[model samples]
Target: MAGSAQPSRAQLGSDQSASFRPYVAADQSPAEFTAKAVVIGALFGLLFGASTVYLGLRAGLTVSASIPIAVLAISVLKRLGGSTILENNIVQTIGSAGESVAGGVVFTVPALIFLTPYGPEYFRYFQILMLAAAGGLLGVLMMVPLRRALIVKEHGVLPYPEGAACADVLIAGERGGGLAATVFRGLAVGALWKSLSWILQLFRTAVGYSMARTSFFPNATVDLDISPEYMGVGYVIGPRIAGVMVAGGVLSWMVFLPLLTILGSHMSDPLPPVPASGLRIDQMSAQQIWSAYIRYIGAGAVLAAGIITLVRTLPTI
Candidate 1:
């Protein structure tokens, strides 16, 4: 193994660094963090933030706004007399920050509003604003330490697909190639598809079919949302994570729901904490059963998973 011609540490590092080059060199300083960039980014942030909140409230999930923001920023800045790659990146970062904050607030704050004895009225605008600000500050503070390690040093070692995609968009815009045109075409197609479903009402946005009740299986159902957004997300996350998500859905719908239905159907009275409606489990639909019981189980499972993950990562932290 001695005469195999292994590269020295310095040579290896140089090779690795040379493999990936930034659109703008490190030594170059550009018109980044400019007043126009900040203003444009803030405007986009507010726009996406509002939309994210609405989407989260409706669907309990939010789409990543980074790519769209980057695309828009590039187009806008080009029309406004051109901008640097770093300026566009700064715009994207600031705009996506709003979506991130909105996502976090919508997911957790609603639960607090519902669960607290003081009720939704207790959470005023100022209180919610403060909560969001604190969460965003904490997140930024935590990432400050890890940014160099995970984002900079690791680089290709960690498959940060979203970040990579965003960077590609910025670079493509800067280079003025077919890649940027393709992105705009995709945007147009997505917009048309959404309009067809939402505005024209040509078809259902979601569809579902409930399986017939049998001796073995009961209250089983399958549902799918026909949305470009979800498809894009699944593609971005890749098949393995998507498969795991599908498996969880199957466990909830096919396994747990049927078992619960079979066991509870024989009972004459309504379940506890559900009020005395005199409706037995057998009378309830799959959706009703899920709302009444299975959601709590799912929530518990998520809590357990989070705790386990935190415990595993605590040493590293």
Candidate 2:
């Protein structure tokens, strides 16, 4: 029964201890927490951080780099030899910090540049760096107290989805295959689609039609992007959540945009931001109006939602 599974008390509790066991044990230590792991992890972290910032600025979303960093660290440490799984874990821990910091800063910092009239010059390097450092330290401090309550006590009661997937990847590689092929297939499909749409420009990356000519629904439009990345995200988050998100988009496009166009059309005066020299709102396309005004409204809504969520969760914290 040595090769058989054992239940984990930390996760499954004493009742299920006979059924599951932790991948890592309490006492069996390996060459972990090393300088080389820290250095290599930092490099991976930096790469992910920069890439995450760019992706977030472009897409208004960011993803955790933990799974990918763990995978890469595992592969590298294995090839280099004389490294333990513990060292690999340490490497990923240090490396993923870059992505975490970048993710936080990019949310606020880039908007100060691109969303403002003054542009990138207004964004100071030292100020942004300090902001990121402060945010990162704050997150670490906050999590330190919760490690036992959430990570240990709750255990399998809650799934750390990204971390679990990364562990699966590591184990799969070591055991010489599992459902990892499915993951590779997904990667191949996504890569191929991106190459066609982005690199080759074989087709429009985003395809949409506007109903501007129709008198019944002026400024009402639908837009869809053939983005593999976004599609994958939607698929992962699942249909219900994706549908809710689509509802928000529908509100912005069908209800809000049309209403704004109608209201603006009746007015003879140019709106301050709309510019006195510019054509009236009737003349402006939905895309133009969205760029000039609607984006701020969307950002405000998101901020409000975040604040409300924080307020609701304060008691639990």
Candidate 3:
């Protein structure tokens, strides 16, 4: 009789309330919040897109400075009391999504510029856009299932320093000007480092510092090294994940670099002498090489790690 009894008014309301509560780290209606997110995201995306394009063109390389820019923008906005901390984060997250999309687009878009010399097709802008969108969607979808396991459950497992720092900024802002000195210090330090580094390089023209051969270190192979980029990556990833990355770096540099150098010398019609401005091993032919190789390997490693993580977290979830 109890099992068959209808629910009371309070019980019904409780169920409705639970159903209506917002999810995804924000407390707002999906349609309304998402609309606001889209507008805010678009503005940030335009800024990031413009900055990236300008910097990339000027530097002759792709430089992803969007994350810091977004963080700085949010921090500045908080000082003005124009938006809440959560709102700023939401806007930043939404806007920063464009960089991910642009990354995928740029990879293939360059083919139009360089590959056209050998082929008929030129500038697959539409194809690149579609691929970029698909990749962006996939990344979002993949990260969705991991958010709870990574962000919610594993509190200290993933340090996520950037997120923590953003939170700290917001909390400090609430207390009024507590973070002003820290912000000023960060900017001053960054500017000083850049200025000093440039000044030191005034007379010396160091050419081989790219993903090619290094002139300073003879026979050195260049890949992504341990730099500020990697350190920031390590900080957000926590020590566990950072260790894995270091392992990857060791594998690529310590093992892979030496092997490539040896094998490259023995092969029939071996690579030409190292270029003055290069830092990577001269092993693969242009036709034999593709960016997808590195991408696929990275995807596989991340997939395997994520799957292992999710399996371990299933019971708790």
Residue 179 deviation, candidate 1, in Å? 3.7
| lDDT for predicted candidate 2 compared with the true structure | 0.74
- Cα deviation of 306 in candidate 2 (Å)? 1.1
* Candidate 1 deviant stretches above 4 angstroms: 1-27, 54-63, 111-126, 145-161, 211-216, 268-283, 308-317
lDDT of 2 by residue, 1-317 (tens): 77988765454642343454777787787677788888899888888888788767766777677776777776677667746667767777777788988988888776566567775776688878888889999989988999866666655655678877877766665554333345457779988998987899888877776777346778788988868767766766688977877888898888888887887888786655764238677677788777667777777887898899999967544
Residue 26 lDDT in model 2? 72
Q: What's every prediction's RMSD, in angstroms?
A: 4.3, 6.4, 9.8
Model 3 spans with C-alpha error above 4 angstroms = 1-43, 46-74, 78-81, 99-126, 134-177, 180-184, 195-200, 203-247, 261-317
Point out where model 2 deviates above 4 Å: 1-23, 111-121, 152-161, 164-189, 272-280
The better-scoring model by TM-score among 1 and 3 is: 1
Report the number of clashing residue pairs per model: 0, 7, 6
Decide which is better by lDDT, 2 or 3. 2
Candidate 2 vs candidate 3, TM-score winner: 2
Task: Assess each prediction's global lDDT (C-alpha) against the native.
Answer: 0.81, 0.74, 0.52
Q: Can you write out model 3's per-residue Cα lDDT over 19-84, one digit (the tens) per residue?
A: 553223465432224455457667777767665554334322344434454455456565554555
lDDT of 1 by residue, 189-249 (tens): 8789999999998989798877766646787888889777676667756799778778888
Candidates in order, TM-scores: namely 0.77, 0.77, 0.47
Residue 8 of model 3 has an lDDT of: 61
